[model samples]
Target: MATPGTAKRMWALDSPTFTVDKSLLLLGASGECTIPMPAFLIEHPKGLVLFDTGLVPAAATDPEGVYGPLAEHLGLSFLPEQTVDAQLEALGYKLSDIKYVIASHTHFDHTGGLYLFPDAQFYVGEGDMRFGFWPDPAGAGFFRQADIEPLRGRNVLEVPGVDHDVFGDGSVVILFTPGHTPGELSLLVRLPGRNFILTGDTVHLRDALTTIAPMPHDADTVQSLRSIRRLNLLRDSADATIWISHDPEDWAEFKHAPNCFE
Candidate 1:
């Protein structure tokens, strides 16, 4: 059970803007190709939880090794100064202090910094781990072995169904939302005075959620829409604030590092 009156706090770690052409790739129809990617930090009574690990500094400097072809495809030229570790340190928290990490999915961008938090228990969807560790490197959803190698044999909480209560007391819950990837998931945190839902990539932008638009590269467009609807339902039920991982508008609206949710 969660501690009574537990205050939930969140911080924006990285806020990097990119062109839509570079982000959505084949999905941009209007040539309005620009978007922003933001990562979040959550503080709970149970422990410090990081929603998605943003791009590591190494990846930006050595794009060839970390980003591979994706960088070229997206036309990425620079990286953000605030890495996950640096941002956490700024808040007086170290990587080791983050006891748990919930990754919405294992895509390169989301999982790039997993190695940095080696001590944190990882929480991911069951199908995501399978998709990430597929034997075939050519597979559509395969993840780099280097990124996940350190997590081997560590504590991994795999959600089997569409939704799971992480702390029993409802302080934290992991929502399984497939579409962007086979097992993409979201996070919902119940705070002292508010609630929050971390939408991994279910709806990259607020526009997508309002219009219920599906991204072109999703595994299943229909499933993605269903997931979005589920998020809407949760939002209404909990009166929660929805945080889209890559929406620049949402990032701009939220307070940045050193300022937390609580």
Candidate 2:
């Protein structure tokens, strides 16, 4: 094994913001909440890897252009500069530089930019891909046929129902975390000094971890709860920092782009 921290550098890309009823994210929660949509860029000795891709750049000017029928329901407010392409450019990198694109799931927001990295190797959960083909009606809106349609003829690796170590070095791993959808996956990054587990909507809010609150749209509430507990155990047993990718509070604290976590 290449020891921990085999990945050299990592950055959280800037992303557009979106608002939704708090109840949509957490069960029994009230009020509306605006949360940042973020994608992460990591540099491994192997090459550049992106965790998610945020929303489409065009969505900045036309939310409808991105969300279509779901635009108004989303209440998204995106800025031109918040696009992943722009943020990568600002950081002296470009979409083509990324060698690997790991989709947390087929959710439009998370895999929005997959088309940008056509040449890059793509990794996703088999279940998510299957869901894309046959989505649970409850979570159907979360998907965009266009988001995944582009994978056609491209090199894509569908991870099975277990954790996958991307580099075989114990540095960057893809955790099989489903339930939110049928195949939502999470990420694990091991730095020399510390480790991190980025929960990609495993539980949208940190509080859900303690509350054991459920997302009404989850395909399987029981499975979702199991996944949440799995995350908790992973965090404790691995002594890793758990980051809820969509939580507004998490967004505020994260060092975006020009700054990064090494």
Candidate 3:
């Protein structure tokens, strides 16, 4: 179901993560201190597609307000130098050229740079958007109103449930993988030479995939595990490489900055 004359390419941008102190409640049973955070860019003939927007460059200097909590949690002093715009520009593309912006979920980190593509159509799970706007009290601060307010009426594609072929061709598909966030979603891309499944927080680290470690916090533990299983099955069946959005090791393995996979 892939379209003709179109090539799919993937780019892994800067990678960053937050480490939880043992004093702070342990996340998984193993109680690992570090977690991986990554962002991706998808290149196609039609236009460029960005998976989850990493931290905004501005957050590095100020590290207060909305990012204050995140900064504290991460125990980092400065943010990474590679902003989404800079990374894309290095690859010979501009923010305006990105026609579609698909977010795995509406968490602040994932949606931070969404404002850069205000004109592009955003694809998100229908339930996720609703839950983001009215998240549970405990999860309210995770969704930033400023980041998502601009996308209200423009081209917002909301998928109800199940995996959706966004382009009606198998070239791009948005798969519903909830758990980390209420309406979390992942993408399955059929590239020319290879295939990839962008596992947006469905399975954070390689350990999670192999040992079934629990994420720090999840909307539903059972749903998250089920989603991970589904992704594993799809990856094995399609022979597609699974890219976890927040895996530093995986990010280091891919082409970075100007270089991309096509």
Best by lDDT, which number? 2
Estimate the TM-score of every prediction: 0.87, 0.95, 0.87
Ranking by lDDT: 2, 3, 1
- For candidate 3, write residues 135-238 as lDDT tens digits: 88876866776677777887998878778876666777888988888778998887888788988877777767776655766777888889888888989877
Angstrom error at residue 46, model 3: 1.9
| Residue 210 lDDT (model 1) | 77
Among all windows of 10 consecutive residues in model 3, the one with the lowest summed lDDT is: 21-30
Query: Candidate 2 lDDT, tens digit per residue, 111-199?
Result: 77888898999998867887886787767878888888889889999888889989988889999988887778999988766678988
Better of 2 and 3 by lDDT: 2
| Candidate 2 TM-score, C-alpha based | 0.95
Candidate 2 weakest ten by summed lDDT: 1-10
Measured by TM-score, the strongest candidate is: 2
Score candidate 3 by lDDT. 0.74
Backbone clash pairs for candidate 1 read 9-262, 10-261, 19-33, 19-34, 20-33, 20-34, 21-33
Query: How would the candidate models be sorted by TM-score, starting from the highest?
Result: 2, 3, 1
